[model samples]
Target: MLEATIPVKHKVGLHARPASLFVQTAAKFSSAIKVKNLSANGNFVDAKSIIMVLTLGVMKDHEIVIQTEGADADAALAALKSLIESNFGES
Candidate 1:
């Protein structure tokens, strides 16, 4: 398994559209992905599920730990890291 801690920089964080985008990105990977909101001290949840991701209550500047396992773990981590680092493509 591969894991990385990433900070959410989007204005609204992981909610609504951002959470949807995050779930969408995770769904593209064949690997199993999980996310935990470090700042919130939350437990890990399915990254591919919009509802679970939303439950993390990830607000702006909150740190999250993403774990990926399986054939595409590396790619999955990189993709998710990129998404958060890029602020979910928001300006």
Candidate 2:
């Protein structure tokens, strides 16, 4: 498995449209992706599920740990990391 801790950079965090975009990005990968909100005490959820992701209650500057396993794990992690770092292109 590949993992990375990424900070949420979007002003509104991962909610609504941002969450939707995240789910979409996660789904593009064949790797199993999971996310844990470290700031929320480490509850992990499926990254491809919008409902599961929304439950994280992620907020701006909150740190999240992303894990990817299986084929294309590296690519998936890189893409997701870039998306978050890009602020979901919201700025």
Give the local distance difference test score of model 1.
Answer: 0.92
Least accurate stretch of 10 residues (summed lDDT) in model 1?
82-91
In model 2, the worst 10-residue window by lDDT is: 82-91
- Deviation from truth (RMSD, Å), model 2: 0.9
**Poorly placed runs, candidate 2 (over 4 Å):** none
Strongest candidate by TM-score:
1
Clashing pairs in 1: none
TM-score of each: 0.96, 0.95
lDDT of 1 by residue, 2-74 (tens): 9999899998989988898899999999999999999987799999998889999999999999999999999
Candidate 2, 1-91: lDDT as tens digits: 9999999978788998889999999999999999999989757899999999999999998999999999999999999999998889865
Q: What are the root-mean-square deviations of the candidates from the true structure over C-alphas? A: 0.7, 0.9
Candidate 2 lands at a TM-score of 0.95
CA-lDDT, candidates in order = 0.92, 0.92
